[model samples]
Target: MYYGKIIGGVLGLLVLGPIGLILGLIVGHLFDNGLMQTLKFASPQNIARIKQSFFETTFLLSGYLAKADGHISRQEVDHTEAVIAQMGLNAEQRKRAIELFKRGSAADFQPEPAISAFMEICRGQRQLCQTLLFFLISLALADHKIEAAERQALQRLATGLGFNAAQLEQMLRMAQAQGHFHGSSGFEAQPGTRLEDAYTALGVDPDVDDKTLKRAYRKLMSENHPDKLIARGVPEDMIKLATERSQEIQAAYEMIKKSRE
Candidate 1:
């Protein structure tokens, strides 16, 4: 059996008793079947390097997106600060992140180098790459709308991250759908949550069969599993985002299931 299976099973059992073990095993199976990329870093030093790279690329690309529409708006700057605050960075880390953001926003800065460096560090881990893109997408939508230039820059970054146009669009839709769950304490549909948003959240058409819908939900849950993300080199602090993603997925699935029933 894959190490993912064993570790997932053990963690599940420890965290949630019996039911969590079954869920963890299922996720581990997905990991073994190629849903998650193989971990490349074997040493503490390499792990630290990977974490640093992830942090640097995140702020750098965020700055690039913020400046894509010519001038970075005050709203964008505030949003970026909010994101940094949510990360709960220490004094030194926050300082470094702000510096990276400024460097990326400089008129002479080119996003290609940062994108390439991040890609190399990610080693083709699709889920990790998606997580990165999700952060950028969230930033792009922070102003409540995506500008043409911002969209264009996002597309370029997506291509560099090994996603095609279609995949990026799918992620975009899912990200937008996720917005419905923001600022809410619970996962259930808040008042005014549209059914269409739920469908988009799953990245599926309403006409899709029950089995297909369930499959999409499962795939999303597996892809955003917090434990899997952390094991794959995502910083522990950042796992909160992934956990929120899982909640959104669950809420969307519940809404869709209720509608069909």
Candidate 2:
């Protein structure tokens, strides 16, 4: 049996909070089942563990979101494949991601259980949690519009992960902009079409001061930096997502700068 969901479902951890309780249960269960003999969670390995949880769970939830509309569309499949290509996963890693995705797409899959573990891994890093949400939102909007089922599912996930409705709506719109911007590969901008989206993507405003705008730009870039994300335990394959996010941030920043100039 796949122990990922089993530990994710450990009921006791929910009452204990994010750090020791959840991870303790996970490591203990793994050791008890002879999955691993020794466990060391000092910085490096700990970060890797969190990263693995985040990465694997992202794919799992991606599958769930895609299947929310009852059936996964060809568009959704293509989008997922495109992302897999971008991540450049090795054969084994790719297989694992695919399996996780499939598990998430199952009809009986319950998100609440795994989500508990996800929340724990993301306990202190609000930005990281929000960043993960953004990527999931992007996946939801891959087919252009968010279906009713998809929207409802997202609301549950967002609420569980500590995002408000407004935050989810805002990210949904930005992810829509991201789809268009990335689809065009930065070459096809209709005049004035992306103005508002550009600002929203950078979390800034057209009227913002130079310093404020620059600060937002730098902070977003730093947060989504590929190397930083990799160090945080994001798999090498997911670096493409980081790179794309940076490109969008840069594109949005440049558009605003030109308007100001």
Candidate 3:
């Protein structure tokens, strides 16, 4: 009888190899629930920690970016609040975000722990990480300007999230090409004529004179320069976009110069 049963089991395995494997897996999982849980889902404590860390890191970084241009304008604060509201964070999360923002605005904003935690969270959920970055980009441009230091900091965060240079550059280009200049709206101007629009994209006045234009261009270039952007966490792919924007600005300046002449 034993021999017969063994023979029958071998026959079943041969007849249903995949099904047998699946069943074996299910039985094994049942027997090793602890291992399975550890491998698949984060512990409750870890989940809470991750959520807290994400909120803190995001708020801190956003605050840092807001203050990068010497002062955090009311517009920036309002924009950040809007972002916070949109995130649909719970009371605890909202409170944590505020605390982080306060810490981030301090004279010494050390981003290492936040960055590390962000990376860990991103490793587990890439989509969430991307979403967080998208929010940061929006925050950086909230005041219609991207400061050099702010851009640098953003790029650094992107890189720390494991985005390669090429990937970062691509994302930046997509962001620019999408004409996110005035938030998430589409392109609002045509080519060439977009010179003034480009200035607007950089949050500058279209009628700026040569001296001011040059100064603004220099300031923007200093921040968005490919190398500096790369150093700051801009993905390599998005660096090209920043380069293109810089070129557009130069072109606009030249056009304005010719018009003045």
Candidate 4:
């Protein structure tokens, strides 16, 4: 008799082993031909693969975005290096990231395949997708303003990844206010931060109620949580961005609370 759960071929021996078990995490499959799906689990190898894919895509996309404006300015190059330093990537990883960036910056570089592959391997995780987009946007705005070419490139990339115009605009505003990408939606505890920028970060209007405000803050925090991303196969080394972002979000919320009181 075929059991409902995963079972061996009569003698109760499993052939697929870890591969079958890990498939459940990425694909959530079920066999119809009297065979059971592999026991549900996410393998360590799968986690590593997911992280690597994210790392590669982010590096390449960063280059592509930078070059969208006819030439990458010296300031933009410095900004890229600053971000790399902020990520705290190791020597070998940094070298590989640089290589990927160069390839994407080529005059005839193609972005569709890279975007498609990124979406596929990401398993449709919206937060990861948002995070990746967030990083690219931050890089684009690093020179204090986004040129026409940069905006068009971002819009195309955003649309290709299933995000609409509204979401992209909202993200750009929040990323600019926060000055970094960690998934949070608020500004840092910097001096003279305008209340309007705080509202923009949390993506709420001035007329929003306290209840709605808090909810938005909580949602952003959860989505941008470093531990949450790490648990879902994001590279451990990249957690620093989220960590710093958490601090900024907290600061923004605190500032909002003070104004309300």
Instruction: Itemize residue pairs with steric clashes in candidate 2.
Output: 87-237
In model 3, the worst 10-residue window by lDDT is 180-189
Candidate 1, residues 1-261: lDDT per residue as tens digits? 487788899999999999999989998888876633333354556666677788899889888889999999988998888878888989998999999999888888888888788778767678888899998898898888999999899999999889999999998998888778665477777678899999998899889999999999999999888777776778876777778788888988988888888
Give the clash count for each candidate. 0, 1, 19, 1
List ranges where model 4 is wrong by over 4 Å.
1-41, 180-188
Structural RMSD, model 4: 7.5
Which prediction has more favorable lDDT, 3 or 4?
4
The reply for model 2, stretches above 4 Å from the true place, is 1-42, 184-192
- Candidate 2 at 97: error in angstroms? 1.4
lDDT of 4 by residue, 137-208 (tens): 868977889999999999988987789999999999887776532233444456656877678777888789
Query: Per-residue CA lDDT of candidate 2, range 1-261, in tens?
Result: 446435654644675666646675676576555543223332676777778888888888888989998999888888888888887878998898899999999999988777789777645357667767877887887777888999999998788778989988877776666454454546333455568778877776668899998998899889888777776566666777878878877777777888887
- Candidate 3, residues 1-261, lDDT tens digits: the string is 133334445554676786765555555545466555554445555555555555567788887767766788898889877766765667986787788887887768866667786776535355446545755776776666677777777777787666766666555643453352222332233343445445554445767777887787687567657775443343343344455456555554555566678
Residue 22 Cα positional deviation in candidate 4, in Å, after optimal superposition? 28
C-alpha TM-score for every candidate = 0.81, 0.78, 0.51, 0.81
Number of the predicted model whose lDDT against the real structure is largest: 1
Clashing pairs in 1: none
